[model samples]
Structures are given as C-alpha cells and as structure tokens.
Target: MAASRRLTQFALVMTVAAALAAAGCASGLGGGTYQRTEARRTMTVQFGTVESVRPVLLEGTKTPVGAGAGAAVGGLAGSTIGHGRGAAAGAILGAVAGGLAGAAIEEGVTRRQGVEITVRLEGGSYLAVVQEDEGEQFRPGERVRLLRDGGTTRVTR
Candidate 1:
C-alpha cells in the first residue's frame, strides 16, 4: 500500500510537470520579438492598473493508482477491527471507501490556480498575461517606455 501511494504521488507530480513544460513551450512560441533598428527613437508609454485579479482553475483528471492505494490502506485498517469473514468483508468495504476518499483528496489538492493580468498597451492594444505571481501590480494609465535596438514601444497615459 505504501509503495502504491508513493508511485501514485510520483505519477501525479510527473503529469503536472509535463503539463507545465508543454505550456511553457506554447508560450515561448507566442511572444513576439522586436528587431534592433539602426535609428534611435524615444516613445511614451501608458499603463493600466489591474482592475481585477481572477484565479483560473485548471481541471484535473483522475489516476487509477490513487484510488488503488487508498483502497489498500483502507482495507488494511478495516481488517484490524473484525475477525474471520467479518474482517475480510470489512477490509473490502473499507478499501472502496478509502479509494474514493483518496481520489477526492488528490483531486482537490492538485488543482492549480493562475492569475490573469489585463494591461492596456499605448497603441490601444489590450494584452492579457497569465502569470504565476499574483503580487505584481500595474497601475492604469501609467506611462512607460521600452528602448529596443533604437525603436521604442511606448505606452502613454
């Protein structure tokens, strides 16, 4: 039972890691790149304050190992309470109950929450970025400038 629980935990961690890797790959492909220009330029930038922060809940799927481990542990515990056929039957019933409880607990704990930030670009483009850090804050109508290879992307208030 202990071995099964350990394996289940490892599998869950691996699955989550894979999903995070995939998401990172996807994001790396999406951000646009700025080319360096020969000319020098200055620009004014505008910023927007975060009106609201929303947590995005990612749905998680179930793993059979979690249930199996739960059942095994439950059965073992249940078997200790009775004798003969009663003990055997109790173990089976306990295993089923434990499996369900384990599954529910795993599901609840593995859920991930992401923060979405809405920013207004200077050129009137609205950009939303999902970030793991929720403590970062940007004020609305703030002026900011980015110096890139001579060309500047400015956000003006």
Candidate 2:
C-alpha cells in the first residue's frame, strides 16, 4: 500500500515536471506583426566583407516554470513524508530544493552556443553580428549582406 502510494506520487511529480517543460516550449514563440517595443521600419540591406568569425555561448534566462514545477512536486512529496508540523517543514524544504533544481534545468535546456561574425563594411567600418550557428558558416573575407530592420539586424550570404 505504502509502496503504491509512493509510486503514484512519483508519477504525479514526473507528469507535472513534463507539463511545465512543455508549457515553456509553447510560450516561447511570439506572434509576428511586431512587438510594441521593437522598432518599426523596413529592412536596410548593406554589403560587407566578413572580417572574423568567433564562437560564443549565449546564456539562458530563467523562468518560473522549473521552480513552479519543482515546488509543486516537492510539496506533494514532502506532504507524504511526515505529520502536520513535520509535513509543513518538509514541504518548505522540498519547494526550495525543487525551485533551484528547476531553474538549473531550465537554464541548461535553453542555453546555446553560436557564432559572432564581424564584418567590415565598404567604408572600412566594422560591425559584429551574433546569431545561431545553423551550419551556415561564415569565413573571413567572404561577401555577405547585413540586413538592419528597426532595432534588429542580421547577417546573411
């Protein structure tokens, strides 16, 4: 009986964690039109020569998904462990631990490495653009297009 209860709780916790992760993935996408904070304008295209290419790791930002999931799971598991006062204490500890673990997991999942391409424009000026390395590698001295749209910019072949 006790073993079955423990198994059920464990499964519930796992389900909650999976749901939280899926939620994160779903909310990550933004609708197109334009963001209120983003600059509104047409893309300004310019030709440039790649001056350098360097690899870089982009840090991930934390969200409540992990902590929230962790807390719910921890609280549930903790509730099963003790009597009234002890149960409360266990829940608190579990929540803190779960939150920390969730945050770490989120960071790990979202973190990515990319490349910074430094391009020297026709007038001898330099600009660097960092983007996801989608296998479209850029080499020094290679010709490319720099597209600037409002406050955002991108480099392409």
Candidate 3:
C-alpha cells in the first residue's frame, strides 16, 4: 500500500512539472512576427539607411514556474530515500539543487541570437533597434524601414 501511494505521488509530481514547463514556453521576438494584440493597430513608418549591424544575445525569462516545479519534483524524490529526519534533510538538499538546475535550463532553452541594427534616418538622426535574428541579414548602407507602434520599434528591409 505504501509503495502504491509513493508511485501515485511520483506520477502526479511529474505531470505537474511537465505542465509548468509547457506554460512557461517563450514566444518568438523576430522582426516578421506580430503579437495578437498588435494586429489591426496602425504603426508609424519611417525611412532610414542601415549604418551598422551587430550580433547580440537576447536573454531568457526568469520566472517562478521552473523553480517551483523543480523543487517539488526534487523534494518528492529525496523523501523516498530515507526515513523521518534523514528524509527531511535529503528533501531540503535536493530541492535547492533542483531549483538551481531548473532555472539554468529554462534560461538556456529560451535564449536567442539577436541583432542590433543602427540606422540613420532621413533627418540626420540615428536610432538603434534590437530584434531576434531570424535569418534576416542587414548590411551597412542598405535601405531599411522603421515601424513604430507606441514604444516598440522594429527594423526591416
């Protein structure tokens, strides 16, 4: 009976952990992509010439979901190793280690390669925009377009 209960608990913990991870999946930040809310909204357009393009790393999100799921799974696995006080100590250690690993994995999975494009507008002013690379290449002196929606701006050829 005790073994059956433990198995059930383990299954439940795994299910919950998978659900949390799926919920935290990151969305694309590419130039061609648009969020649902951004559709049908008017954006101001401006013309520019690309002055420079540099590679960048876009950082991933840091959220509680990953840490929480890891801790729960680790604690459950640790508790099965010993009895009473020993089990408690093992759970604590396991949870700390699991939480750290989970956070690192989450960040690594969502990290993306990006580009910083510097442009000189028609008015002799310079502006820079960073966006996910998405296989789009830019060169110095190439003509580009800048689209602005509220505080967000993107560069496109």
TM for every model, in the order presented, reads 0.45, 0.79, 0.87
For residues 1-157, write the lDDT of model 3, one tens digit per residue: 5986679487657846684566466777878878888989999999999999999999977777667767776776676667899989988987887777767766776789999999999999999999999998999999999999987798887
Q: Which of the predicted structures, 2 or 3, would earn the higher TM-score when compared with the native?
A: 3
Candidate 1 stretches with Cα past 4 Å from truth are 1-52, 56-61, 120-134, 137-157
Candidate 3 residue-wise lDDT at 104: 72
- Pairs of colliding residues, candidate 3: none
lDDT of 1 by residue, 29-107 (tens): 1113233542354533345544444556644446665566567666766665568999899888988897897666555
Most accurate candidate by lDDT = 3
**CA lDDT, candidate 2, residue 68:** 78
The lDDT of each candidate is 0.52, 0.74, 0.82
> How many residue pairs clash in all the candidates, one count each?
12, 0, 0
Q: What number of backbone clashes does candidate 3 have, counting pairs of residues 3 or more apart or in separate chains?
A: 0
Give the TM-score ranking, best first: 3, 2, 1
Q: Name the best candidate (by TM-score).
A: 3
**Model 2, range 1-157, lDDT digits (tens) per residue?**
6886888587766857684565456222111223455555567888999999998886665777766776777776776668899979988988788778777777777766678999999988999988766667889989999887757677888
Deviation of model 1 at 116, angstroms:
2.8
Query: What is the Cα root-mean-square deviation between model 3 and the actual structure?
Result: 2.5
